[model samples]
Target: MPGKDSKEGKNKNQILADLAMADARRMIQAWTPPVWDEGRRPRISLLRAKKAVPSADGTDLVDWSREERNLGWDMYDKNFFADVVDIEGHHYEVFKFEFIEDISNKMKKALDDLEWVALDG
Candidate 1:
């Protein structure tokens, strides 16, 4: 059985995580692309929250590469490569591919500019 101190610490950690998630949600909601194409735009809500890890140097800085990898994993699990077809019965795999690539680049840019540490549910 854990001590009172341990339980309290866990509760405090949960509270902090909740707060961080809320902040990330707000940032994601506020983010917008320079050129908004509703058809090709990614569903921002699909993005998942990622846990922060310590820097490789054992400093307070975040491990950005790890964060990027986390984002990639989320993107992969979210089916970023899923196929799409137009209403006219035309299949444009290249179009969807380009759109996904563009969105990924934009998202990475946002992550850097916004200093976003995590996302929300």
Candidate 2:
């Protein structure tokens, strides 16, 4: 894991993953939260949250906007490549997902903290 320690020389995914984790850590900025774990590499799971704002007639949200969002696990992938996004049209945005709240803490070690993360949003 020498490469893991020396972040400077890492590839795109590794560097990005480190940055993602760092950003998350900074955002939480709590004395105790979830620290990155290098053991269990996280598996990217697809998530779709529909926009819930109701429209006229009070029917389900319209598909004109699709109201669909794409989100997945942010992690480092050196052995393989992985990316998921929301593609509604020519325009698109990378989606970021918080680790499932209940599992975020306990799942830290279960995630490969050493790997960098990114999303081609």
Candidate 3:
């Protein structure tokens, strides 16, 4: 049988996973894609929070706003390509995707530690 510490660690990781999922759901709900057509109505703001990290320059810092903005753009592309977002009802289908790996082409195999990290609000 596994020890108490091992069980505790697993439980903690599970909690983190649950929290991350919730945050992701909220992000999806809050995002509004830019208007594409004259007849289509624009999306209104709901909620927005970004993910950030410390830059290689240390204190300089890599901001999450950029990444979040990029993610939004990528999402728009995906929607356009897939025709997933509804312009009439403002409803979007929730899809699962990896943050750094799936969205970033150049980032492939570049980010080791952050490969598994999910976007945070």
Model 1 over residues 15-75: C-alpha lDDT tens digits? Answer: 5654786787688778753444554544332232233432233522222333453344344
Model 2: residues with Cα > 4 Å off, grouped in runs: 1-7, 30-121
Predictions ranked by TM-score, top down? Answer: 3, 1, 2
Give, for candidate 3, the lowest lDDT window spanning 10 residues: 85-94
The C-alpha RMSD of each candidate to the native structure, in angstroms, is 17.4, 19.9, 17.4
Q: Tell me the TM-score of each prediction against the true structure.
A: 0.24, 0.21, 0.26
Each prediction's total of clashing residue pairs, residues at least 3 apart in sequence or on different chains, is 0, 10, 1
Q: How far does residue 108 in candidate 1 sit from its true spot (Å)?
A: 18
Clashing pairs in 3: 51-64
Q: What is the lDDT of candidate 2?
A: 0.37
Q: Give lDDT tens digits, candidate 3, residues 78-119.
A: 333211211111111111243333334323323432333323
Per-residue alpha-carbon lDDT of model 2 for 1-121, expressed as tens digits?
4545453455565556658767865775564424446644444533233333233445322233343233112222332213332222121112324434423433343333323342322
Model 2: weakest 10-residue lDDT segment is 85-94
The lDDT of model 1 is 0.40
Better of 1 and 3 by TM-score: 3
What is residue 74's positional error in candidate 2, in angstroms?
A: 23
How close to the true structure is residue 67 of candidate 3, measured as C-alpha lDDT?
Answer: 39
